[model samples]
Target: MKNIKSLLLLLIITSFGFSSCQKDIVFVEGSGPGGTKPTTYTTKMSAKVDGVLVECEFAYAQQYTNPDGTKDIQIYGIKSAQSFILDFQNFKGVGTYNAADLISSGTYVSGVNDPFNNGHYAESGTIKVTTYNSKVIIGTFEFKAVNTIGEIKTITEGQFVISLEPIPGPTPGNTTTNITAKVDGVATDFTGQAAYVKSTLIGNVMTIVGTNGVKAITIAIYNYKGSGTYEIDIDAQGSYNEDQSQTGSYATENGVKTGKLIITSATSNTIKGTFEFTAPNMVSSLSTKKTITEGKFDMSYTTTTM
Candidate 1:
């Protein structure tokens, strides 16, 4: 999840523009589940383009708390650069809203394609709020949107379950001063005697990078901020900063040496984790695979927002 925070920020601006809006809208419901209620927040959207059925999966969820005591639910579905955004203002009970009703409220903005100046508008559609609580929101939506060039796209089967509660922070734990591991059966250590270990946690992802002289290793865990084992995301996991891009550098590979990130503990200001990976030389001609094992880290971090 590289630059995910940036991506979400852009999405907030292009999708809803919460800050520039008018009076707030609030959605609230009592606790406990009713009969036949869903247990999760899930969403999907699809349509037919050029006689081919194209489905866009729900990609992200964001909730904006307004100063006027109102809230906005922002859901995004993406199929390539083309996308759709559904904004539910003051999302309350199980109610149906048509295009006119939603537009009149000025809290609704449903559209397709790029959401910038060149975006499209939904000519007609309905948004339904099935159920909601402080923890989750469940809803369904459909729209017939057209672009400025007079291109029409029908979006259907749109639904989502967005979690609204805050994520739990890590517990209290001791901090270690060094990171120890082995590279291809050779002992490797980063005692923090020369350089400090740097760590950053944003959303559910945590990234850590350490160095010793010219050798550096980076480890990242996605969809994770708690104690658990996670398989590396091959495309955006970690890298070995050696080789100086000569013959290319090395990356964590799935097979051959298989990579793993194990987070033992976490807190708002501290994190502890272990990792291992079979770093493959990006340049295929370089046959050496750096095996990093028994890797460990315990570091403190600070939070920053943009």
Candidate 2:
């Protein structure tokens, strides 16, 4: 009994001494599925705003490699109709980065009604690159952004892992074949060896450019990532430009009268589709309306991956 009491007293003293010499520290990690450690290069992120769960998506043009070997890595997070852009510039490898300035800092908004009205700028933030390699890129970030309406949001515990690859280009035979269409009841065929097809993804939008002989056509689809029927609008649709002039005669036009694009196949590096639209020449005083039909395009083009 006496030995037990002494042992208890010694344990009490030791516990007190240990507690006195102990220090407490806290570590906050990124939140989400596989946030702490990512196994693959798939752009994904999650954060918290005002103690509420906020989920965000990484944009298509999330990463870009400059000619000088510097890399511009950007990640976008959207939650509750609000969006933010975290821009990390001149980042080549694993290291710490500061928000630097307006250009490099994060930007945010309540909603993006127009493509031109992107969002507001981030006043401050910090990003730590945890992983970077040919296999994958991972990072954690936190920032504060204010909208144009003077609303501020604190983005916290942000982390992302995205697949990395060099920018892609159209296949060798992308422009070798002939692309046929009808314009204003006139049969048109874009042919020749110099003819080329180019497709680019900006954010969620996709723009396909095709040029043959003296005619060039540009088609844009909003939120285009897969096969679907996309409606055409006036301010942002299809156009045909006459390149005969030295200055190039321009046509600011929109799709009218049952204008639609039907995408049949979409892959990582290829897209095939058909389209029909009525385009009006906005540059001319007459506003000449051109009916485009029987349009078909099959091209293998590359994209800039995140």
By lDDT, who's the top model here? 2
Judge candidate 1 at residue 7 and give its lDDT.
40
Q: How does each model score on TM-score?
A: 0.38, 0.44
Let me know the TM-score candidate 1 reaches against the reference structure: 0.38
* Model 1 agreement with the true structure over 68-158: per-residue lDDT tens digits: 6665555655554345556656655467766324531211223322333335556787877786665555677666766667766665666
Worst 10 residues of 1 by lDDT: 193-202
Clashing pairs in 2: 41-163
Q: Which sections of candidate 2 miss by over 4 Å?
A: 1-42, 57-61, 78-80, 100-103, 114-118, 165-218, 221-294, 297-306
What C-alpha lDDT do the candidate models reach, one value each? Answer: 0.52, 0.53
Please report how far candidate 1 places residue 103 from its true position, in Å.
4.8
Output the number of the TM-score-best candidate. Answer: 2
| Candidate 1 accuracy as lDDT | 0.52
> Every model's Cα RMSD, please?
18.6, 22.4
